[model samples]
Target: MHSDRGGQYCGNVYRQLLHDHQTVRSQSRRGDCYDNAQAESLWSRLKTEVLEVRERPVFADLADAQRSVADYFDYYNHERRHSRIDYQTMYHSHQQLTTLSTLNCPA
Candidate 1:
């Protein structure tokens, strides 16, 4: 439910739909650019990297679109870098978890 403070993003119909599904709405604070900056960054990356690819961005089937989105999510979680986490990709963080555990182990 986290989104920018835009009227069209969670307009009346969308709000009603969420209400029907019993979901809470959360929005960024007004006039604060960084409040929901992470969500904005993810959306920008999805559109630019997944939807606007060079080999034409139209999907002829629902499964294709779903697969494409899934692939992007996998890449985002595994390969993408985040500065907040010392510029380490998520894949590396998970890998380093076992490394740290092994170092701390007695045997």
Candidate 2:
């Protein structure tokens, strides 16, 4: 639901898809570049890892591209170690947070 104020996000096709799913639309305040930094960073990494290394970044088909991107994200979330979180894997961090939250809840 969170995105920059891009034209496509405000367009009918995208709005309709969100409406159909009953999701709220949220956008960053105009002119706030920092609000989108995380997404931009991810895009930069994806392009560098999968697209920019090759001369022709085009895939044989759309599904191939989707699969490649999905695989990259899966690896990023489940396997890649992040120095920001004491070099822990993202999956472990998420599990720890989940366990902490569950323990904090009343029986």
Q: What TM-score, computed on C-alpha atoms, does each candidate reach?
A: 0.71, 0.78
Could you give candidate 1's per-residue lDDT for residues 1-107 as a string of tens digits? 77787887668998898899998988888899999776778889999987777465478689998998898889887988878779898778878998999999997
Q: Candidate 2 has what TM-score? A: 0.78
Query: Residue 34 in candidate 2 has what lDDT?
Result: 91
Number of the top candidate by lDDT?
2
lDDT of 2 at 28: 88
Provide C-alpha RMSD values for all models, in order.
Answer: 5.0, 2.3
| lDDT digits (tens) for residues 1-107 of candidate 2 | 99999999989999999999999999888999999887887788788887887566567789988998999899888888878778998889999999999999899
Best by TM-score: 2
Per-candidate count of clashing residue pairs (backbone under 3 Å): 0, 0
The local distance difference test score of each candidate is: 0.83, 0.88
lDDT of 1 at 95: 85
What TM-score number comes out for model 1? 0.71
